[model samples]
Target: MKGDVIFGKKGKLSPMFIGPFEILEKIGTLAYRVALPPMLAGVRNVFHISMMRKYTSNLSNVLNYEPLQLTPNMSYEERPTEILGRQEKKLRNKVIQIVKVKWLNHLEEEATWKTDKDMRTRYSALFDKY
Candidate 1:
């Protein structure tokens, strides 16, 4: 398949992007055209799809993607600490306390182990042996 990609001539293989790049270019021009707003073509979805494809990759769903070190306690900086200390809080808060104690343990989830393990795993500079 890759040989088809590499060795094939410019027009030999199917267009890899299937002309979204052309549409994206048009959207850019339309964004600048305040004189005509509806020329945008109900294209918010198109813009969202383009941005998502640009910023994120299939790697985001893979387990092999490098883990990020997030300070679970200080991680939710937007939330107040009082939320953690609230006694009347439900079991979730108790769970948060346990997570704070274990640092990255906050990511722990049952049934779905991959996300939790990926979050807690200490990633190294070295590549995976696999």
Candidate 2:
């Protein structure tokens, strides 16, 4: 089941270990571990990707070269770096604001609450509930 009809099998095998995207993603991970040098690792990764491309030709849900689509809001062919850069710029500010807001909330909560409940609980009603 490793290669394909390119080898000894005349017909397709039933429940063949071909793929679901999880296996293809796993191939990416395995490709990373292949005994290649860093530069060759990139090339080998592309090769394994092309191998995936051949089999996934018919499925609509199967993206050609993509492992996991990071954005559902944006399409892959849209050159997402520009979108990412803008989003990241916005996110940086938002995160800073969130941190400040959280700091203020923590201060407010500390002022409001004299004491917080402890986690440990004694179960006197265990058999009573049973």
Candidate 3:
């Protein structure tokens, strides 16, 4: 289907599917030619059918899709938005501090636990309020 929406990988974020891009044409029996945006000029327009998933539109499943600014290498920087919680893990010899990190464009539930030292070094602002 030419006008049907399909899932395309964008970056290292949860709900990794980036677009419901227009399907230009079928490449062969198992491939498709997608119409990617100008920002994704460096990306190949063709994709195998296995790599794509049909996007079923739903009113309750709204996604806030923002266009990502990719560098020449097709990579983008992901930033931390907030520190959700903190905990200390006790080892045999010592205790290590870890923080729950909420990243930009990700939901709170998707936040990950990272070492406090690492989070402080990369996202010091998250600790400013505490």
Candidate 4:
């Protein structure tokens, strides 16, 4: 479940599905026991039907959906690619700068707005012109 992509934090850029795993057995009427890879050992094999999707017969789909190469800790890095836009939020006594950041390997729509100060501290090259 943790390895499979979801719609929120990572946005639409995340993969929709991760497998065509073998269904070991049916669980009552709503769930199935799937044989997941060793990488997903920590997760429960039983999943709700809503979480599964019918696979379209496309060789490309299998080739394109590269399973995430995860660390032993089961986490991956998300690095920012570039700054797309910027804005300032004016408070009572200070101005807060924010920038829309495009992430590496992700589309423009997946970009998120973050505080400029934090971005600058982490990725100073993104603000070279300013």
Candidate 5:
């Protein structure tokens, strides 16, 4: 549809969808031109149908989305929000400590396991509470 919203990109540790941009016009049988915000001026406005997914609006599914301050390269850094849990992986020689990390702009179920040592060295403040 012309006014439908769609998923932009599947970025790592970022929101699955970006905007509810209006469809400007249909380019061909398989492509459509999108009305993109000024912040995404550098991005290509036309997209194929296969790359888009219709966004369904639900009051309960609404989220408070904070726009990221992207660098010149159209990228932003992802930071850890908290340490959820910890576990140890035993290898043949040594044991590796891993921590479940919840990152900003992500849900609890999306949390990932990362090396405790590397996370501590990079983001030591997250470990202060524990």
Candidate 6:
């Protein structure tokens, strides 16, 4: 439930905000039934007041903004754009490989360190140059 996220972490550092969404009605004292995009149709739209934030006029404040693109199951794919760096971590006798990945539409500071195996499977093209 990514309710009106402006500046926060999303499974590493994907900043997203989906609002200016209208309040459909007040569900109770602390909750409001807000109108959400059709992509979020499968989930409940009612949110606690704490989840919502006051509106801001400056659009660029939405850091590395990327519009929510939902799939049939109401899930969005977060694609990594590039392999920024790599490292190897030693765990007992085994070595684990990790890569710093820059997600598409995300800023450099938001780039996340992910498992190299995971990146290879999900974004094989990121390694085509290597």
State the lDDT of candidate 3 residue by residue for 4-122, as single tens digits: 33334333443546688999999779999999989778778999999899899989887678788889999888889888888999999999999888888778899999999998887
Q: By the lDDT metric, which is better: model 1 or model 5?
A: 5
TM-score of each: 0.14, 0.15, 0.54, 0.52, 0.55, 0.47
Which tens-of-lDDT digit does each residue in 3-109 have in candidate 5?
A: 33323433354455567889999997999999998878877999999878898888987778878878899988899999999999999999999999999878899
Model 1 TM-score is 0.14
lDDT of every model, 2 decimals:
0.31, 0.29, 0.83, 0.83, 0.86, 0.80
Ranking by TM-score: 5, 3, 4, 6, 2, 1
For candidate 1, the 10 contiguous residues with the lowest summed lDDT are 78-87
Question: Which regions of candidate 3 are displaced past 4 Å?
Answer: 1-62
lDDT of 1 by residue, 16-119 (tens): 43212333233453232112133334434344343333424465555543454557653532221111111122374453211121223233232121122232
**Residue pairs in steric clash, candidate 4?**
none
Q: What is the lDDT of residue 94 in candidate 4?
A: 95
Give the poorly placed runs of model 2, Cα more than 4 Å off: 1-8, 11-17, 24-47, 54-130
lDDT of 2 by residue, 1-130 (tens): 4444422344556333333333323444424222434333333322254354234455567544425445685534311111001111145345221111112212333322111111012222321322
RMSD of each: 18.0, 21.9, 8.3, 7.5, 8.0, 7.9
Colliding residue pairs in candidate 5: none
Which of 2 and 6 is ahead in TM-score?
6
Better of 3 and 6 by TM-score: 3
For candidate 4, give the lDDT. 0.83
Tell me the spans in candidate 1 whose CA falls farther than 4 Å from its real position: 1-24, 32-43, 47-100, 105-130
Candidate 6 residue lDDT tens string, 1-130: 5544333345534554557789999986999998887766775888899888889678676655567778898777778888899999899999999999998767899999999998899788879989
lDDT tens per residue, model 4, 11-128? 5567667888899999999999999888778778999999999877876665433466688999877889888899998999999999999987577899999999899998888788
